[model samples]
Target: MFLDILLYIFIGIIVLQFIYYIGIFSVFSFKKAEKKNPNHVPVSVIVCAKNEAENVTRLIPELLNQNYPDFEIILIDDASSDETLEIFEEFEKQHSKIRLVKVENNEAFWGNKKYALTLGIKTAKKPYLLFTDADCFIPSNQWIAEMTAHFTEKKTIVLGYGKYKKIKGSLLNKLIRYETLLTAIQYFSWAKKGKPYMGVGRNLAYNQSEFYKVNGFIDHMSIRSGDDDLFINQAATKNNTEICYSLESFTISEPKTTFNSWYRQKRRHVSTASHYKFFDKAQLALFYACNISFFILAIVLLVTQHQWILVTALIAFRYLFTWISVGCGAGKLHEKDVVYWYPFLEVTLIFTQFSVFIHNKFSKPVHWK
Candidate 1:
């Protein structure tokens, strides 16, 4: 009887996993992208930098030459000890629309990018604010126009896609790209279903009025990270938030080549998860737990009862179904290469994410830019 009970428990977990996959299918299957009209609302593009002189040297020109009309680039110099300030000064001279907001490194104000970004928003003359990082590059000049086009009536928030550049073949590079796509799948799918929880800071947009209405991240100011997600978590609504998936709207950033750098980057991002609203937190936790639990139980069922037929069928069904649904999502997101690695990446991603989630509990908060 004890052996039979153990078998039933494992079977139940696999059933739960199947149900979760079905939920993903339902969300993706019924959703269709909406048409957007071209909108030329005056926008302020904000870039906060600590010491990104090299990157901005190549990045600022792209901002100035965008295909949109009436947009200004707000480059905030957050106490850079490098050539960042000098470079921006030169750009400001050449381009009349470029505005510079400098944050002095004082004992009172140091290391917080959120504070610097808030200053940028305050200095912006435009009604709309579109944010990206210094290390990121626009795919095309149409980036601004495409993102702003989604700001229809009542749509106050726009979430845009940001991708990492593909590097020389390595396990870490592939994993990093796959992880980014996986994150995109979750947030985008949820947003499509009218339950947006967060967005990437690298490419996101919102109205200037909404910033002051929420008091501008005052609650989470102490947090060094989450200038993007935490703000949106508080500000986004079913009727107010919309996502822009146009190919030209995306931004690409250089990926961390070393494992240590990537690990630290992910830790800072995961640290913000604790601050998410309860419902959103529980939903994300459930997805991770179910995914890991499903595979663990399948292994036990195979080992203990030699239930080869049952175990094989369930695992096969999961792998095949997930490949199909996530493959479709990958295609839509321009992450087609990740589809080939989904099965192998499943085990790798779950274990790494579980480790990071546990580590985040004891980790000291790190500075973000």
Candidate 2:
């Protein structure tokens, strides 16, 4: 009787997984990249740095090479202890399109990203704004063009894929890359369905007016981090949000080199999820709960030999759908290499996230930079 009950739960979880893969995730996997923007408008590209001198040095030259005709680069030095400010000043003097915004540490909002970003947004002179990290690599000059293609008069928020650099001979790199890929898949899929919730700051763009509409992150500015997602969670509606995942639009960032650093980063990111809308939290929780439980339940039933054939069938069926949906998404985002390791990487990541949730209850991440 006990084994049968377990089998039933396993079956139920597998069904939910099937629904997510077929119904929700497939929206992004089967979709095509958007066309070019004929009506490209003036844009202010914002990059905020705390102490990323070396990274920004490499980044500035690439930002200047963007093919977009009308755009300015707004480099915000958020109270850097290093030479980040000096580098920004030099770039500003060299290029006519480069601008600078220096932000000192606020006593009430110390080390807060939203505070620094708010100052940068207010300083922008353009109608449209594009944001990225100082450490990110821009491979294509058409990144601004591709990202802005979806921005019609009504569609103001544009979300793009911010991928991590692929490091060969490193399992940790594969895991991190897969996690990033999966995140893009979920957010892009949600935006495609017209229920956009959150976006990453690494490759997100929007209208400056929309920032003013939500009062520019004042609701959650007390808490550090969430300059990108929390703002989108508050500002992005079904009608105004648009998603872009073209290869040309991707901004690649270096991944955490060690497990300890990666854990801290993941914990910080997961902590922000608690502040998301109630429905967003619930649905995400459901998907992860089902995903994690599927593996656990499948293993238990197979070991106890409770309807082993039926349990095996359910596991196989769920993974088949997973491969198709996740595989297509990886392909679309040019992450086909990570798709093969999804079976292993996904199980590890889900359990790792569960561990992160348990650990975060005792300690929370307080710093954004």
Candidate 3:
């Protein structure tokens, strides 16, 4: 009878996961972004850099080559001790479209990227602002066009994909990308469900009005890591947000090659989740907790051989439905290779995230770099 109780719990979790898969996530898997805004509005492409000279060097030229019309590049040198400021000045000289915003290290907001970004956002000449990191590059010149196409009168926020490069023979690369794909599916799908929460800075776009309306990240300026997600979590609304997944709209960056490096990056990201709106935070926690519980209960029920056949069928059914749902999402996001490795990656990530949560309880991550 005790095993029956556990079995019921497992079934309930499966039902919850299915609700997420079918109700919230299914829209993004099959829906295509109608990137149809025909006008190429004047745009300001903003990037913040701190000791990222080499990456910024490659990025500036790639940004210079974007095919969008009537656009200018604003590169903010965030108190870099390196030659990043000099590089920005050089590009400013060579190109008339490049503008530079230099932010000195503020003792009050030391090492905070948001301080530098606020300066850059204020300096932007265009009302439409697009953001990316120093290391990111566009797959095509049509990136700005594709992203801005989603910016209609009501849709002031445009969320785009930022994918890590896939390296063969590196399991870390696959794991990082799989996680990225999974996150994208949830955020994009949630936006489709009319409860927009967050967006990646690497390919995010928004109108400057939204920034000034929210007082421009002043609310969470103390936190160095949430310039993108936190701002969207507070500013994005169902009627104001839009999703753009056109191939040209995606930004690409290199994945962290080492597990330690990736872990540190993840810690900074995870620290921001606590500040998310109540509903967003609660739903995310519920989803992750149910995922972990599903595997735990399934293993115990089967190993004990209590109603083994029923448990086996339930497990098979759950995995089959998950594969179909996630496989569709992976194909849409250009990560179909991750589909076969889904179960393994999902289990590992659940535990890895649990470790990160515990670690964050003891320590905090600082600095944008």
Candidate 4:
């Protein structure tokens, strides 16, 4: 009887979190672009590439051809071992707006990417700074114009979505898309409710002034891989952050092929999750705990033969709630097809969370690719 009561209480808590996510999703509408005067605000697009020779050669041309009135591309080669610098030199020959910056020696002050971004930002002559990864490709020519329009006096920080490209014969591609969609659901829903906690570094924008105001990751400098999210968490005000959902403003990146590469990348990311504020950490913990408890309780109920109908109903309710919430988010991110893969995705998420927990508990310092 005590175990049954405890299970009931856990079920109730999970239901409450389901409703909370739903309410958050329904409150703030996805951001849409509006017509505005052709104001030429000076803007700088910064991209840091380490061993991304092919991506730089291909994506730089698209960034240079943006329809924006005024902007410059600052490409930083972070001591890459590959021919990244050689490729950048070839692109710089054709485009005047494309400036190549190389970090030959680490000043021994910051992480490789952070150092590269700091160097690019220092040389930037614009008031607004946009950060994107080298592997990402912007969707449209007007992507910058559409994204920048949302940066008014009210909204200082902008978070945009990035999807993974679908590749045939690669289960890794499917998994990457599912992971991205799930992450977007949590962050986007939170952003919608003005309780923004995290933002993706791959496609994020903020003012130079805001960056300096937060001391530019001074608190988390020793820990790498959080320069984007930690900085936003420190700098963004309640009314200063906005999320962009338009297709024109979205980005797409190729997925890693091997599981080992993906595992290392995810492990690096998990280390920073603990650095979030107490309340934010509590919320995340509750969410993950519910998922784990649900799975465990279902297995116990099956073995003990305790109120099978009630247990099945609770399980169904939880599944329905997650599917709807995750489905809404997947739609907004343009991965609607992945919705059909939700059952497998949910199972995968549990294992993924367990891996993250173990990694955080036992893993050593990780290096970024």
Per model, how many backbone clashes are there?
0, 0, 0, 0
Residue 210 error, candidate 4, Å: 0.7
Assess every candidate by TM-score.
0.95, 0.98, 0.98, 0.93
Clashing pairs in 3: none
Candidate with the larger TM-score of 1 and 4: 1
- Candidate 3 local lDDT, 249-277, one digit each (tens): 89999999999999989999999999999
lDDT of 4 by residue, 29-62 (tens): 2344335443456789999889998888778878
Give the local distance difference test score of model 4: 0.78
Itemize residue pairs with steric clashes in candidate 4: none
The C-alpha lDDT values of all candidates are 0.84, 0.90, 0.91, 0.78
Q: Write the per-residue lDDT of candidate 2 for residues 201-288, one digit (tens) a residue.
A: 9999999999999898899987677888888888999999988887899999999999889999998888888999998999899999
Give lDDT: candidate 2, residue 257: 95
What TM-score does prediction 1 earn? 0.95
What are the RMSDs of all candidates, in order?
1.8, 1.0, 1.0, 2.2
Question: Candidate 4, which segments miss by more than 4 Å at Cα?
Answer: 28-40
